[model samples]
Target: MSTLTRARRKLRAHPVAADAALAAGVLACMVAGSFAEPHGPEGIDWGVRTPDVLSLVLMTLAAAALAFRRRAPRTVLAVASGASVVESVTGDPRAPVAMCAVIALYTVAATTDRPTTWRIGLLTTTVLTGASMAAGPLPWYAQENLAIFAWTGIGATAGDAVRSRRAFVQAIRERAERAERTREEEARRRVAEERLRIARDLHDVVAHHIALVNVQAGVAAHVMDKRPDQAKEALAHVREASRSALGELRATVGLLRQSGDPEAPTEPAPGLDRLDELAGTFRSAGLPVEVARGDEGAGLPAAVDLAAYRIVQEALTNVRKHAGADARAEVSVVRVGPRIEITVLDDGAGQDQDHAPGGGHGLLGMRERVTALGGTLTTGPRYGGGFRVHAILPVTTRTSGARDGRP
Candidate 1:
């Protein structure tokens, strides 16, 4: 960067040293000005005109006070103004002691509010000008008295402008920081929602297939020696169930892969169209599941279709695990007015499994899926025995079209 830019940055880094240097520079200028004649030959100024010892002492004191202007601005202004008044009243030819007061007034104006700057700046200007005009050898109309008024006013005006610019810059910086924080919070919220969605998908896939595999594996172990053919068939079902589970798992986890990875499987997500296939898998595992539908050929929104399929899959999986072996499940899909309804009823000898150990998250996941699609789900014990799950999903093209619009 430029040399001037580097020097300013260094000064800002060491405020005390910077202020000390300012005080020294002001002292040098005032000391040099003290000797210059205010008026010379032909009504102009020249040569050196030395001030009395008291004026010199006051000038020195005023410049020194400027070193701490930033630390105590009001106190420094008071000291500097007092020194200028003393020089104005007592000196034969007034020294440029008021230069130091002007600097102090600028510091006060820059640090304090506008009202205080006005009060202090006016008081200093009045006192110094009045003193020089009334008590000095020069008359009230002397150019020196007028110069004092002008310089002090310039100091206050310049200082106030600098303060306003600093405030404006600070406000802009705070607004930018607040916008950055809001963006970060929005990103985090989206990430959390995506994680929950993936988690629910994984749960549904694993729970359904694993339960079937467990059942088929148990059958193979029980009949391995007594019925070789039946054991082979059971083992084949286990292998098929496991392969399907892996395929679904790979598809689900593929969503989390980086862009550089191999392409994911193009197989379409399962829906009600696969309901019979899903039921067949349960039948092979010894849970008799029957599906009935009155919706006919009506197309569903992609989200509603997926939700309905998963609800059925999860409900049947629960029935196979918790319902008695003799229990049978009936799943029905019906178009009722403006909504599609799905009901799964099981005659299994199982109690309310919602509060049972290891059964909590299934119902909650179902509820979340239904709610996310702006649908409603109810699950509880049936009138006589077993469990029931009923869900009502909107069938409007508008709802489905909205879901289609999302990534």
Candidate 2:
């Protein structure tokens, strides 16, 4: 930082020292004013001789001490006030001794709490004004004595005002800074959530399609020469897998774009209505797929349907990968009054079902998708002997306004 800025910062950090310097300057001016010839007021020319060197020296010392008034406010006030009283009672009362005392009072008021300032300030003003009037052989209402009273009051009032304004400004700045931090933190949290949802979706989509490709490639390799036609069909399955992978990959990646970007894709997401096409893909793979429908199809929102389809698809893919070839899986969809229920079951001995329910990514992704849309999912071994994936999705979607449009 520049030298000027550094200096200002240092002074602000030590406001007491700054106030003391100001008080010292004002005291110096008052001392100079005291040197002016005292015009005999009201023709009372009985001034024997002006205050000698001794009284002047005392006034100067007291004024000089005012420079540290804010640093040690009580000490400065006590010392300056005592010096003023001594000047009034012992030395010449005409000297400018009260100047340092007035400055010290103001500093005390500004640095300390207001109640303390008021009590101390009022006592100091009364003492200075009363001593000046009574010790000078003048009436209590003399102009000089009243001027001390007014100056003391002004000093206390002005100091309090300065302190209050500084406090108010500091409070406003703190509140604004806190609000800015909250906004930044909230934005970061939203970004992190979006990234997680996108990652989950990618995991589910890729795992399903990639697993299928792996299966087809293995079959094709095993039958390349003896079953040339079967190899061609396996290659076709590979093509289908690659295409589906591309489409789902696009859907997952599309979430990365800014919501308002012109390049962003505008497309309808998969929903429950598309479950038929999904089932057909499984049927083509020789898995006997059965589907059930409900009359209130229009009630299901797009997001709910998509989550439902993903749940069923993920479950079926796991069955194909893990279940024995003879296993016949039953996939059922039912709609109750307020919910759509999905269940995937296999008659095979599903001791492995203990682990199938662990989505690692697929089941996890399914749960996140379902809950994001205010739904619930459960997966475990069915009673008597098979693996089961069941999910309950609400007809009314949860609009959480999160990134990736999870809701």
Model 1 residue 314 CA deviation in Å: 1.0
Q: What is the C-alpha RMSD of each candidate to the true structure, in Å?
A: 3.2, 4.5
- Scored against the true structure, residue 92 in model 2 reaches a CA lDDT of 46
Off by over 4 Å in 1: 1-10, 41-44, 126-142, 336-338, 394-407
Global lDDT of each model? 0.89, 0.75
Per-model TM against the reference: 0.87, 0.83
List model 1 lDDT by residue over 163-238, tens digit each: 9999999999999999999999999999998999999999999999999999999999999999999999999999
Candidate 2, residues 88-197, lDDT tens digits: the string is: 76754666677778777877887888898889988988888878778865566867678778988898887788778878899999999999999999999998898887
**Global CA lDDT of candidate 2, please?**
0.75
The parts of candidate 2 lying over 4 Å away from their true place are: 1-24, 37-50, 133-136, 258-262, 348-359, 398-407
Clashing residue pairs in candidate 1 (N, C-alpha, C atoms within 3 angstroms)? 35-49, 40-44
Q: Which candidate tops TM-score?
A: 1
lDDT of 1 at 218: 96
